[model samples]
Target: MDRIANIHTLTKRLIVMTAISLLVFSVIFGISYFFNGRLMMTWLGFVCGIIGGFVSIQQRIKNVSDEELTLLTNSWFQILLVPIFGGVFSLVLYCIFLAGIISGNMFPNFYIPKPSGSVPDANFMIELFTKTYPLTGQDFAKFLFWSFVAGFSERFVPQIVNNVADKSSEKVNPSDR
Candidate 1:
């Protein structure tokens, strides 16, 4: 009985998180395409948002204590932060790409040419979102690799940072006299 209830709760959490993630991904992709006129950021945001939302939900399920289960049951909204953070990270990477900080060695032909002197309007942005870019086999492979990195990095980097912070804090505070 208890096991069935736990499973039921997990199922609900997963459904809520996935729905919220889809909404977030769509909105972020639309906004990113509007501002950047690029599909890369939109793709990255969608991938990262979905992956981050699921990963965070999994973490919550694993870490939930009996006392915390009631709190977690009603906290489906908290999972939205994971995707938002991931999308922001993707945007930062897109900015770095625009700034020429990263080269397209693996994807030399991945560039999508933008129209000159024509500012993108809502229709243009919508069209851009609906349109698909042509990618060679190699370019597609590189994109998949980068997308996975972007999706995973959102969760991975924070764990690395927290681990480093914990180590440094322990060294500074020396628990044992």
Candidate 2:
């Protein structure tokens, strides 16, 4: 009876936490959209991450074995970390995709500004960042999909990161090879 009650409390906490998180993200994303179109991709990715977190938590509590649940020492703080990790992982994966290391299809497409010799001004840096940051419409959905996947699969991004690290190691130390 105690175990069941504890489980209900945890589930309710997660639901409330996730709802608050979604509202916050949406508000921020809405404000950011007007200032910089490029931020939309990043914003959407984080939202997807939060959703993934919520889904992951719901799924976890549903099937958590009695023995597994019993042996674990846990708290609301611990459970809340899943969505937090989800959002962070989504951002990291976005960077990896932006770097074009994953796949040609996964790379974010963007508008290429024509080279112009313009005098520096207050707007120059802002304009440059705005141009460089946003993804073109063509690949927007693709990136969004991958970002959600990254948040959902806890193992996937870590595996890719490790693989990237391994590949990078060779470039740093030729003597080892």
Candidate 1's displacement at residue 148, Å, is: 4.4
TM match of model 1 to true structure: 0.50
Give the alpha carbon lDDT tens digit for every residue of 1-177 in model 1.
364476468667767767766786677778867987655445654565456546655655656776555554556565455555665555444433334445667631344445444886776655544443435667555544544454445655355447656877888989652
Which residue window of length 10 is worst by lDDT in model 1? 107-116
- Which ten residues in a row are the worst by lDDT in model 2? 108-117
lDDT of 2 by residue, 40-112 (tens): 5566778787678777877777578766554322566666577778878898887776666786765566543
Against the true structure, candidate 2 has what lDDT?
0.71
Using Cα atoms with residue i matched to residue i, what is each candidate's TM-score against the true structure?
Answer: 0.50, 0.74
Off by over 4 Å in 1: 1-8, 23-44, 64-70, 103-109, 112-135, 155-177
**Top candidate (lDDT):** 2
- Which candidate leads the pack in TM-score? 2
Candidate 2: TM-score?
Answer: 0.74
On the 0 to 100 scale, the lDDT of residue 41 in model 1 is 40
